[model samples]
Every structure is written in structure tokens, then in C-alpha cells.
Target: MEIINFGKGYPANVLLPHTLMQKACESHLQEEKKLFLHYGHKQGEEKFRELLASFLQQNYKTAIEKEDLLITCGASQGLDLICQHFTKPGDTIFIEEPSYFLVFKIFTDRGLNLVPINTGKNGLDLAELESKLKAHNPVFFYTIPTFQNPGGTTLQEEQRQKLVALSEKHDFLIVADEVYHLLDYSMRSPFPFCHYSKRVLSLGSFSKILAPGLRLGWIHCCSTLLNKMLEDSVLGSGGGFNRFISGQVYSFIKLGFQQQHLKLLIGSYRLRSGALYYFLTTILPDVICSPPEGGYFLWVELPKGINAQQLLERAKKHGVTFHPGYKFSTQKKLNNFIRLSFSFYDCDILEEGIRRLAKCF
Candidate 1:
């Protein structure tokens, strides 16, 4: 039998817009050759930033200007660039208890210590956060606020506002990973975190809404931060990251292809997430999992006396696999949990994957 990979958080091949991307590339390249084919601007092509700003304003329902944007190869690169400039090797950094697992590697690779803050379906535990804030002065609190990975939680608007205030009070930056912000399916998350303060740096990526292969993303921050990076050697020496890719994407957004593609992705993922949730509940009644309001993942708690890693071994034997929750933990604790992603497959495959998981149980 075929292995069903519910742990793989990737866009389905069917979901990728081949035609739209081809059209964008063909249309943009067919135009009069310009500086985009050369070293390009250090802060991305100006016209691309202008179009991105307008698209973001309409989608997020908030105001942002091109001056606030800085282009990067992708969100991961943006995070690494921030750490390189803004942090020291031994500085403490706060992250959600179960963050995007790959991000844990990013910070750890930079020799930064990771502190796990409590988070759940309701969002960040502010009381616990404030209590911890009294003890550690972190460089920044790295957060995935909307439809967060693994947890699928969205921090409320009020909490976000207060979080910004605390950031100012404590003098720590707010690094918001907002790649999943526009992938909402009936979820009304707060406005982009960068809007609340200049201390907040919001990272947006085309990897999610568009195609990951494009390797285009932007950091939304204050002019001070943008100017600092613009003058930095990483950008000044090489010019903008993904300049050519950004140029082609200018047409993608201009032609209204991004909006149309997002709508299709949202609709498809909604059905898949709901199907996975339904199967888990009906087939294995003991498992505790909430239906996601948006985003790609479903975080599930195993039944009593169940260990996720041990279950995974059995699941592999049954031709299904998922991410054990401990993989996402900084302290390696949440062994009774698991993360399943619904973006990679259809309902039929998800159902089979769940049934295979049930057999493992």
C-alpha cells in the first residue's frame, strides 16, 4: 500500500497555479528588458513593492506603505537575516511552546537559546507570559499569530495590542510570521502585527499563497529597521533577494492572479481540514482535536496512555505518518500530541490516513 503523509505541510500539486505562473513569467519577461535583469535595487524592485503594498492593504484591511517593505528570498531567509543583525549568540528568545519545528532549528543553529511561552487554542497565555517576562529579557518574541502552525491558533486583537504594549515596555522586538495570514477560511484573525508598532516586524511570503519555488517574501517593518538593513552588507552587496522573481510576481498580483489563486486554495483546504477532523473524531472518539478555523494544520491530543512517537512507529508500519508533537517542543514535552497537515492531500487520502492511524491506535 502507499504511505499517506499527513505530516507533510505542502501545497498539493493540483493546487499549484502552473498556468498563472507561466503567464506571469512570460508576460513580464516579454516586456522591454530593464534593470530587473541586472543587479536590481537593494530593497527589491520599487514597482513590485508598490504593488505588494496595495495587495496587502486590501487583503489585511490595514494600511501599509512600500517604504515599510524589504524583500527576502523567503520567510526563513528573513528570519535568519533578522537574527544575524539583531541578536547575539547567547541571547534568549521567546517562542510559542510548540512552534514551527523548522524554526526551532533556525534559532538553535544561530546558538540562540529558546524559551517556550504557553499557547493553546485560545492563544497565548498572557498571565504566564507576563510572569515569564519579569524573569527573561529576550531580544524578541518570535510569534506565528494567525492560524499558527501546529497549534492552528489565532491570537485575538486585544491580546495583540497588549502584547505590543508589553514589547515596548520590555524593549523586546515582536517578530511576527504572517505567511499564513491570508489563508483564512472563516477565521477573523487580528490585523497584521506590524501595524500595532514599529517594534513589530511582520514577515510575509509568496511561498504559501503563490508557489514555494518562487522563493519570494517580504519583511514589513518601520523605516528605521528597513534603512538599517538596506545599508547592511548582506543587502547592499548583493542587491535585493529574488529581484527577478519579484519582478515576475509584479504581474501575478497585477493580473489579479494572486487573489484568484488564494480563493481556490482556501476553498480546497477548508474541505480537507474538515474531513480530517471529522474522521479523527468519528473513528477515534478518544482523540481530542479541534476543527481549525483556518491554516494548514490540525493539532491533536492522543487518548489516555498514548505516546505519539510510539504511535508513529506503529503508523509507519501501517503506511501512514505524521509529526509527533515533541518535534515541535523546545523542551521536548508534549509527547501525547501530534500534528497533522491537511494541505497536501484530498479528503479520500486524508480519510485513509486517519483510518490507518486508527489501526495504529
Candidate 2:
């Protein structure tokens, strides 16, 4: 099928380094041998945590310790674990209106009442956030701080500080999903929320920038809460984690190959994003697209009277498809918006996809 799928944030044009697999195989043969085939530990491997902690501290400026980090299958699972540990059924949580919808489903499935907070061009509006804090005294405020999903907007520096201040003032925790943190289009990558507050629980994953198949992610928090979370993970998932796979990843980082690979990937995506943005702006002038700071997506607001569903129907006929905007909103009112991912396809495919989308418009 000649398909142009701008629907998911999946990496399209990349492949996991064959070298990584070969290295993992070699490591398994040398390090674990028979033990490599066994079940993984629940808490994740120790070396992976240490490597991650050091990487985040050195590169991202987050003072994360090995004790403060817990590995998960990915950040998605980390979200589930956080919900399972912190909030109970009937507790209130604040979510960005146009959020990563999987979070909304997770909170709802766990029986938490969600209060949607509207985000502005720069990111979530602090005034609205404070109002919700006063109204609900929510258990936590969940946000995708950088290159936020669907909106592709990064939180401004002042706004980030305001969020931290609100969490402290109102005594609520912040669950930061920093999955897209490494995808920097910003002048400088924004600081993780934990830098400003101890109450913040930040989630990250290697899925976006690295191999999603790794299913490796981490949660970082302060001492007391992180201790409880680690305990919870042990009870919930059994032991530490997959020693074999984690060991391989740890080895990769120790050798500085992972960072080098990521830098190369980021450079490639930067070019793709620029080309995609230029194509869309030049072809679809009437559409309102966010100026992404650093992330894989462009949240385009179609012309006022255009029906996204109707456009999608026509676009599908031309072998191109994009996510409808309504899927990203809690209230399901953002019908004229759609999220386009430039991470997957080549420039030629992207050019064709934009052309098809333009025809729909």
C-alpha cells in the first residue's frame, strides 16, 4: 500500500543499529551465558539505572541518583505504576486539555477524576492551572512539558517556574512525561521539572530517540517517594529487571555509543522536521501549525470551517492519513486540528503526503 501515515509518533525512517544487536549478543555470550535467557528482574538492572542517572545528570542537568530512578517497560508503564502507587480511586488529577490521550485513559481506568486544563501557544496556562489547584486540590498535575504531544509546544521558562511554584504552594505533585525531551528544536533544551521541585516525578523513555523495541524507560523522583515507588515496583513486577537486555543497554552507554547514536538521530530528525514544516507552510498556507521547539510532531490547525474528519476521508483516498484532532482532546472538541509526525517517512514520502493533504484542503 502506498501509505503516508502521519498518525502515530513512531520512528519511520530509522532502524535499530545492527551493531547494537550484535553487541548485545556478544555481551550475552560473554557476561551472562545461561543466565541471559531467564526472566528479568522487577526493579530493572542496576547498571542501567546508574548509566541513565549519569547520562541525565551530565547532559540533561537533572540531579538524578541511581536510588531515585526505577526502570519500567517504557514510560507508559511508569505512568501506570505512578497511578497505581500515588492516587486511589476517586482522587482528582489535572490533565492538559490537549494531552497525550493515553494518560487520560490510564487515569480514568484507575478511577481517578480528571480535570482538563487548557494549554496556550507556549504551553499550559499557569492561571488556569492555579485555578484548578484551588478548585480541586488535585493529587497531581500531569504534563508533557517539552514538545508536548499533539500540540508540539514547549513550556516557556517562566511558565515552567510558575508550575513548580504552584505545585509547592498548593502542595500537589507534578508527573512530568519527558519522553520527547531529547528531541530538541529549542534554542536550548528546557530543564526537567524536577530541577525546580522535589515533588515532581519525571518520566522518560529510550523509545522515542532510541529503539522503541527496547521498551526501556525510567522514573525519577526524590528520595522518600522514589523509595516507595521502587518498593511498589518490586512487589508489582517481582525483582529488579531484565539483566540481560539492561546489561546490553548499560554497556552501550558506558561505551558512549548510545549518546553518539542519539545525537546523530536528533540531527537527522531536525532536518526532517525543517523540511516537513517548510513543505506544509508552503503548500497549506491556511493551516495553523505550531512552531515546534523540539519534537517529532506538528499540530496543525486546519482552516476554521474545515472538517478534519471529512478531510481525513478524502486524504485517505489519496493514500495519506493523519490523526484527527479530536482524539487528543479530553472534551473531544478540537475537530479542526491534527497531529502530523515527521519522524517516520523520507522527504519524498513526506512531500507526497503533504501534497495529498493539500488536495484535501
Candidate 3:
């Protein structure tokens, strides 16, 4: 039997826009081969940044300028750059109780102290966050405000405004990792945090929307912070971040392929998500999951007394797989929860995966 994979947060291979990417490469090579191939400005390619700024302005409905944007390799590198420039060893950083697990290593490698703030279906608990802020002068609060990883929760707009207010009051930075913002299927999300506060540094990537292989993303922030990040030796010494990839991606975005591709991608995920949710709900009635409005993952709460790790092992034996929730936690809480990604498979595969997972239970 084929292993039914609901474990990895990757786009389905079938959905990758191979033709659009080839066209982008051909167009760039034909028009600006020498310029794109040559060394670019340390800050980024001016044309790419300008085009990206316009793209973001039109889609996100926020005022953005070329000076306020800096291209990075992707969201991972963007987080690393933030840590390298803005934090010190042992500095306090606040993160969602269960966030993107991969990011934990990034923080720990920097020797930063991570404090977990509890989150629910509505997103982070503002009261708990405010209490934590009162006690620690954290360098930044890292969050995936929309369709949060692991939890698959969206932070409400009131909470967002309040969080921004608290950030200003406490003089802390907000590192909003918004890689999944554009993938919403039902409702349009609120304006990004950058629009509300200068203290916010919003991260965006083509990885989720277009393809991760491109390795292109951008940081939106006030000019002051952008200037400081640009001065980092990592960027300055390297000349720029992914200049060639950025130029080609800019061509793709310029031709409006991204918007067209996004509709198809979102529709595919919507079907997969619906199928998975229905199957899990029917097969494991006690399991609790809030169907996500947008993004790749669905967060499930296991029945009482069930351990997700053991479930994972059993499911693996059954030729199925998913992420155990404890991996996403800083304090190793939430052992009864699991994160499942519907982004990597079709409806039939999702159904089979859930069936195998049900057998494990």
C-alpha cells in the first residue's frame, strides 16, 4: 500500500506551475540576462523591490514603498537575519505556545530565552501575553497571526490591534511571520500588523503561494529597521539576497501569473482540507479540530488520555503520518494534539490517509 502522507507542509507536486516558471525564466533571460546574472545591490535589486512593493500594495491594501522592503532568501532566512541583528544571547523572545516547530531551532541556536504564550481557537491569549510582557523586556514577539502553524488559528483583528498597542507600550518588536496570509479560501484576512505599528516587521514568502524552490521572500518594515538589517555583514558581504531568483520571480509576479496560480492552488487545498476534516470528524468523533479558513494545516485535539507521539508511531506502522503536537511546543505541552497538513495530497489520498490514521486509533 502507498504511504498516505499528511505529515509534510508542502504543496502537492501536481500543483507546481512548471510552465509559468519556465516562461518567467525565458522572459528574464531574454530581456535582462546580464543584469539579473550580475551582482546586485546589497539591499536587493531595485526593480524587484519596486515591483514587489507595488504588488503588495495592491493585494494587501497597505502603503508600501521600495525603501521599506528588503528581499531575503525566504522566511527562514528572514527569521535568522532578525535574530542575528536584533537579538543577543539570553534575550527574551515570546512565541505562540505551539508555533512552527522548525523555528524553535532558529531561536535556540541564538541562545534566546523563549517564553510560550497560550493560544486557543481564536489565537494567542492577549491577557497571558500582556502579563508576560510586563515581566520580560523581550526583544521581539514572533507570531504567525493568520492560520498559525500547528494550531491553525487566526488571531482576531481586535487582538491584533491590542497586541500592537502593547508592543508600543512595552517597546518590543513584533516579527509577524505571514507566509500563509494569501492562501485563505473563505474570508480575506485583516491588514497585516505592519500597517498598525512601526514596531512590526512583517515577513512574506513566495514559498507558500508559488513554490518554495524559488527561495524568495521579503521583509516589510520601517526604513530605520530596514537600514539596520541591510548593514548586517551577512547581507552586505554577500552583495544581496537571492538576486537572480528575485529577478525571475519579479518577472513571474509582474506578468500576473501568481494571482492566477493562487486561485487554483487555494481551490485544491480547500477540497483536500474539507475531505480530511470530514473524514477525521466521522472516523474519530471525539477529535476536535477547527476547520481552517485558509492555509495548509488543520490542528486536531486528540481524545483525553491519548498521547500524540504514540499515535504517530502507530499511524506510521499503519503507513500514515502526521506531526505530533509536542514538537511545536517550547515547554513540550499539548501532547494530546496533532498537526495535519492537507497541502501535500489530493482528496483521495487525504481520505486514505485519514482511514489509516483511524485504524491506528
TM-scores across all candidates?
0.98, 0.94, 0.97
**lDDT score, residue 183, model 1?**
89
On residues 138-231, what C-alpha lDDT tens digit does candidate 1 reach at each position? 9999999999898999988899998988998889999999999998987567788987889988889988899999889999999988786777
**Candidate 2, which ten residues in sequence have the lowest lDDT sum?**
32-41
lDDT at residue 259 of model 1 (Cα atoms): 93
Determine which window of 10 residues in candidate 3 has minimal summed lDDT: 31-40
What is each predicted model's overall lDDT from 0 to 1?
Answer: 0.90, 0.81, 0.88
Winner on lDDT (1 vs 2): 1
Q: So what's the TM-score on candidate 1?
A: 0.98
lDDT of each residue in 1-361, candidate 3, tens digit only:
8787777899889999999999988887888747577678987889889988888887788898899888999999999999999999999999998899999999999999999999977679999999887689999999999888878888878889999999888999999999988888776688877888899999999999899998889898998999889898867667898988887888898888888888888898888888889988988898999876889999999998899999989998999988898889998888989999999988878888888898877
Model 2 scores a C-alpha lDDT of 0.81
- Candidate 1: how large is its RMSD? 1.1
Model 2 Cα lDDT, one tens digit per residue, 1-361: 5888998688763545668657755765676545445555555666668778998887686577887787787898889989988999999999887888677788899999988899856678888888766669798989998888879888878888888888888888999999998878654867887887889999988887668888888888887777777667454555654455677777677767778877877877888888889899999988888666687899898888998889999999988999988888888878888889988888888888999888887
Candidates ranked, most accurate by TM-score first: 1, 3, 2
- Cα deviation of 63 in candidate 1 (Å)? 0.5
